[model samples]
Target: MKEKIIIIGAGVSGLVAAINLEKAGFNSVILDQSDRVGGRVKTDYREGYQFDHGFQVLLTQYPAAKKYLNYNLLDLVEFDPGSCIFYHQKKYYIGDPSRKLSLLFPTLLAKIGNVADKLKILKLSKALKKKSFDDIFLAPETTTLVYLKEKGFSDEVIKKFFKPFFTGIFLESELTTSSRKFEFVYKMFAEGSAAIPKKGIQAIPNQLAAQLKNTELEFNTSVEHIKANELVLTNGKTLAFDYCIIAAEAWPIIANLKNQESAWKSVENLYFKVKEKVIKKPLIGLIADEAALVNNIHYQPIKKSDNYLLSVSVIKQHNLSKDELINRVEEDLAIYCDIKVDSFVKYFKIKKALPVMHTVNYMMPPSETQLKDRIFLAGDQLSNGSLNAAMLNGESAARAVIAKIKNGFINVN
Candidate 1:
C-alpha cells in the first residue's frame, strides 16, 4: 500500500509537495484553511476587474517557476523592461538599452543618475550574470544598503532609482534586506521579464493545483494540532498519516515544532477604475520622493475596452481611515499622473505581504526540512522569501519523504 501523507496548507509549497509525492507513487491529502488555493497569491474578480491580493509579478527567469509552471498556457503579459521614475516634479523613463534600442537615449538622458551610475548598472549586471545562484547566495552576507554603497553607487541614484524600485519589491522602505536577495533578484531581472498572467496572478497557483492526480484537497479544513503520527482537526476529528508536511506560514499552532518566530513585511494595495490609462506605457511607475506614501503604480488595461485598472501600492502601514488614505493617495498621484480620488474602487490592506528574511539561501538541506521524525516543514520561510524558494523547499521536502519511504517505512494500513 502507498504511504498516506497529509500536507497542510494548499499554497504553492503544499501543492508542489503533493505533485512530487504523486510522481513518486504516493498518495497525499492537502488541507487548507482558506476556501481556495493560492494562499498569498490569490485574485478576486469583481465586476470584470481582477484584483490580486497584493501587487505581485512573476520573474520569468525563476528556475523553479520555469521548471514547474507552463508559461505559454499562462498567456503572460509582460511589463516594459525598465521603470518610469517620477522624481523632482518630472517623469523620466529609464530602461535597459540592451533589451530595446529605443530606450538607449532615454536611459542615458534620465537625470536619476549620472553616466558613471549607468555604467555601474551594466557592470553590476555583467558581474551578476556570471555568478551562479550558489555563488550569489553563498558569498558574503550584508545589508542591501551596504552592498550598494560598497559598489560605489552615488547617493542620487540610490535614492531616486534603487530606493523606490526595490522598496516596492522588498515591501520595505529601508534597503536592509540581505544583499544576497538583492543580487539574486537583480540577476533575475536582468535575465528575464517581470510579467503577469493574462488572466491574473492567481492563475499560476490554479495551474499547479489542477495537476494533482493522486491527491485530495479539503478546503476550509483547519488542522488544530499534530500529535505523534496523527492530526487533530478543529472539528474534533483525527486522521493518521505516514508523513506530514506543514506548508503554511509559521503559524502558532506549529510554533513548538519549528521553534522559530517569523517577522513579516506588510503592504496596502489600492485599486482604482479609470476612464483612461495613466503613465501610458506598461512599465511600472516609481515615486522617487522620499516622503511619498505611494511607492509604485501599474496601470493594467482592462481587456476589450479603453478603461484601465490602476494598482497603487503603499509599502507602509498608516493610521488614516480609508477615506483619508484615498485622499492622500490622490494627492500623491496628482504629482505625476492625471488621476482623481473619485475613481477609487477597492483596496486590500495585507498585513503579511512577505516574510522578513534576513539571512537568505537558495535552498535548504534535507536534514533541515524535517521538524521531527515524521513531521516536515515546507515554505519560503525555510529558504528565502520568493515564489522560487517556496517551490524549491516544497520539492526538497518531498524528496526527503520519498527517501524515507524507499527505505522501507511502514504503511499505516
Candidate 2:
C-alpha cells in the first residue's frame, strides 16, 4: 500500500503538491476550509460579468509555470506590452519599443522621466539579464528604493513611474520590498508577456487540481489541530497519515503552529462593470499621483456583451461601508479617466495579500521545508510570493517527503 499523505489547504501550492505526490505513487488527500480551490486567486460571476478576487496577471515566462502548465490549454489573453501613466491631467506611454512601435514617439516624449533616466532602465535590464535566476537573489540586497537610487534612477522616474507601477505589484506604497524581488519581477516583464487565462486566474489552480487522480479533495473541511501524524478536523473526525504538508498562507500556518510572526501587506480591490471600455486597448492604467485611493485600473473586456470590466486596486484599506467606499473610488477614478463607473460593484479585501520581505530576511537562507520529520511547510512565504515560487516550494516539499520515506526515516503503515 502507498503511504497516506494529508495536504492541508487547497490553494495553488497545496493542489500542486498533491498532484506531484500522487504522481510519485503516494495516497494524498487535500482538505480546504473553503469550498473553492484557489485561495487568493479566485473569480466570481454575477449577471453575466466576471470579477477576479484580486488584480492578478500571469507572466508567460514564469519558469515553473512554463514547465508544468500547458500554455495552449489555458487560451490566454495578452495585455499590451507597457502601461499608460495618467498623471497631472495627461497620458504618458512607457513600454518596450520592440513590442509596440506605435508607442515609440510617445514613449520618448513622455515626461515621466528624463532621457538619462530612460537609458538607466536599459542598463538595469541588461545587468539583471546577465545574472542567473539563483544569482539574482543571492546578490547584495537592500530596499528597492535604495537599489534604484544606487542605479542612478532619477527621483522623477521613481516617483512618477516606478512608485506607482511597483506599488500596485507589491501592494506597498513605500517600495520597501526587497530589491531581489524587484529585480526578478523586472526581468520577467522585460522578457515575457503578461496575460490572463480566458476564464480567469483561478483557472490556473483548477488545472492543477484536475490532475489529482489519486488524491481526494475534501472541501469546506477545516483542520482543528495537527498532532504529529494525526489530524483532527473541526467536524469531530480524526485521520492518521504518514506525512502532512501545511501548504497555506502565512496567516493560517501561524494560526495552527501558534508561533512565528512575519510582517504582511494588505490590499483592497474594487470591482466594477463599466458600460464601455475605458481605454482603447487592453492595458493597465497606473496612477502616478500617489495620493489617490486607486493604485491602478485594469481594463478587462467581456465577450457577448457591450459592458467591460474595470477593477481598481485601492491604495490602502478603508474603514467604510460598501456604498461609501464605492463613492470614494468613483471620485478618485473620475480624476484619472473620463468614464462613469456603473452599479454592479463588489469589494474584495485581503489582509495578508503578500508577505513583506525585509533586507535581512531576503539574505537569510530559506526556512527548512521539513519540520520535525513528519510535517512540512510549503507556500510563497517560504519562497518569493509569486505563483512560480509557491509551486516550486510545493514541489520541493513533496520531493523532500519522498526522499525521507525512501530513506526509511519515516515509517508508513
Candidate 3:
C-alpha cells in the first residue's frame, strides 16, 4: 500500500514537502489554516489590481529555492545594485560609501570624521564576505555593534546603513540576533541580487502547489491535533495518514500539538500604492531615523502602468492603527524620496511579516522532532528561517517519510 502523508500549512514549506514526498512515491495531502497557499509570498488581486501584503524578495541563490524556481515561468526580475539611498537623522545619502566613486558624494552622506573612516568602511565591506558567521560568533571579544565599532565603523555609518538595512530585513532595530542570521542575510545581498517574481512572490508556491494535483488540499481548514498516524481538523474532520508534516508557523499550530509545542517569531509589514512614482529606482531607499524606525521602499516601477507599490516593514512595533502607520511611512517616504504625501492612492497593512529565526526567542528546533517517527515539523522557522532554509527543511522532512515508505516503513533522505 502507498504510504499516505498529511502535510499541514499550505505555505512554502508544506508545499515543498508535498512535491518531494509525491516524487518519492508517497501520497500526500496539504492543509492550510488560511484559504490559500503561500503564507508570506501572497499576492492579493480582485478589482483590476494585484498587491502583496507581505511583499517578498526572492534570493536566486538560495539553494532549495533554486531547485524549484522556474525563471521562464515565474517571471523573475532582478534588483541588481538597485540604487540604494539611506535616511539618517532626517538627512539622506544617494549611494553606499563603501565604493570608491561613492566617496565623491561624501560631504552629503558620509558623516565620518575623515578619509580614514571611509577607507575603513571600504576595507570592512570587502572583508566581510570572506568571514563566516562562526568567525564572528565564536569570537570572545564582540557583539555585532561592538564588532563594528572595533572595526572603526562610526556611529554615523552604523545608524545610517547597517541599522536601517538590518531593520528592513529582520524587522528589528536592535542587532540582537545570532551573527549567523546577520551574515546569512548580508551575504545574500552582498553576493547576489534581491529579486521578486514578475508575476508575484506567490508564483513559487503556486507552482509547487500545481505540481501536486494528485495531492488533496484542504484550504481554510485548521488542524486541531495529530495523533499516532492521523490529524484532526478544527472542522471536526479526522484524516488518517502514514505520516504527517506540520509546516505552519509555530505560533498558531505548534502550541496545540498532540505531541509538543514550538516557539515562534513575528514580523509586521505595510504596503501602499501611490499615484506617482517617488523614487526612480524601482527597488530603493532605506530609513533609520531618530524616530526609532526602519523600513525599505519598494517602488514598483515595472508595474508603472499600475500603481506604485511602497512596501514597508516594522519588526517589533505593534499597536499602531493602520492610518497612523501609513501616515508615518508616508512622511518617511516623502523625506527619503523627496516626494509628497498626496501621491499615495491606497494603502494596506499586513502584520507578522516574516518568521524571526534565531537560536532563541521562538526559534524552532529542526525538521525532525522528538516524535520523528510519526509527526514532522517543517517551516522557515524550523528550516532555520529563509526561503532556502524552509524549502530545504521541507525536502528533508519529505525525504524522511519517503524513506520510511521505501524501507518497509523505516526512515531515510
Candidate 4:
C-alpha cells in the first residue's frame, strides 16, 4: 500500500513537496491556510498593472534554483546592472559598474581616496563564500552598513553601492540584517545576472503550480492541529496519514514549534502605473543609502495598455502618503530615467509585504528539522527562500520520507 502523507501550507514550498511526494509513489494531501498557492510569490494586476508582492528576480546560477525552475519553458529578462542610477539627496547620479567610485565623485579620485577605495571591493569578492552557515553565528546582525564597514568599505562607497542595493532587499535601508545574508546577496548581485522573468515573476510559481494537476490540492483549508497520527482540520475533521510535511512560512512553523520563540520579518511593496510620456524602456533602480527611501524600482512596459507598470520596494517604512507614494516614486523615476512619470494613467498599492527572508533567523535549518521521525519540515525558508529553494527542498524532504518508507515496504534485494 502507498504511504499516506499530509502536507501543510499550499504555498510554493507545499506544492513542491506534494509533487515530489507523488514522484516517490506516496499519496499526499496538501493543505494551506490561504485561498491560493504561491505564498510570497503573489501578483496583483490592477487596471492592467502588475505587481509582485515579494521576491522579484532569480539567478540561473543559483545552485538549487536551477534544479527545479522550468528552464525549457521559463525565460529570464537579463539585467543591466552595469548601469545603475543612484538617487541621493534628491538627485540621480550614475555610478560605474566596475568598482570605480570616481564616476560618482571625480574629486575623490585625485586624493588617493577613490582610487584606493575601489580596490577594496575587488578584494572582498575574492573571499565571499568561504563559510556557509554550517555551524557558526559569530556576529549579531546589526545592519548591512556595519558589515560593510567591518569589511573596510568607506561610508561613501556604502551609500553609492550597498545602500540602494542591499537595503532594498531586506526592507531595512541601513542593512541591519545579518551579515551572512548580506554576504550571500552581494555575491549573487555581483556575480549573477539580475534577470527578471520575461513574462513576469508570477510565471515561476504559476507554472510550478500548473504542473501539480496530478496531485490533490486542497485550497482555502487550514490545519488546526496534529495529534496521535491524525491531522486535525479547522472544520473539526481529521486526516489520518503515515507521514506529514510542513512547507509553510515561519509563522506556521513557529506556532507549531511549541516552546521555541516564533520568528518573523516584515517587507513592504508599492506599485504604480506611469504616464505614457515616461521612459520608453523598463529599468531597475537601486536607492542610495537612504532609510526612508525605496531601495529599488522595477518598471515594466506594456504598449498594449498605453501604460507602464512600476513597483517600489522599501524595507523600512517609507514617508509617503497615499498620493505621495505614487507621486514621489514617479518623481524619482524622472531623475533616474530622464523621462517624466506624471504621464502614466493610474497606480495602486498592495501591502502584502512579508518576511521573504530576514536577519538572525533567515538562517535555514536542515529539512529534517529537530524531530525524531515521521514529521518533516520543508519550505523556501527551509532552504534560502526562493522559488527554487522551495521546490528543491520539498523534493528533498519528500525523498527523505520515501527512503525511510522504502526500507519497510520493499523486499530485500
The candidate maximizing lDDT is: 1
In model 2, which range of ten residues has the least summed lDDT? 359-368
TM values, all candidates: 0.96, 0.93, 0.83, 0.79
Off by over 4 Å in 4: 88-113, 129-143, 250-261, 276-283, 289-292, 318-340, 343-367, 370-372, 408-413
Sorted on TM-score, highest at the top, how do the candidates line up?
A: 1, 2, 3, 4
Regions of model 1 farther than 4 Å from truth: 255-259, 303-306, 408-413
Alpha-carbon error at 206 in model 4, in Å?
Answer: 2.1
Question: What overall lDDT goes with each candidate model?
Answer: 0.87, 0.79, 0.64, 0.60
Query: Residue-wise lDDT of candidate 1 within 286-333, one digit each (tens)?
Result: 999987889999977554265678899998668999899998998888
Mind sharing the TM-score for model 4?
Answer: 0.79
Indicate which candidate wins on TM-score.
1
**Model 2 residue 75 CA deviation in Å:** 0.9
| Stretches of candidate 3 exceeding 4 Å from the true structure | 46-48, 88-143, 250-268, 292-294, 303-307, 316-319, 343-349, 360-370, 408-413
The deviation in Å at residue 259 for candidate 2 is 2.7
Cα lDDT for residue 272, candidate 1: 76
Model 4 C-alpha lDDT per residue in residues 133-203, reported as the tens digit of each score: 33223446555677778777777777676666666565556566667666666566555666766666777
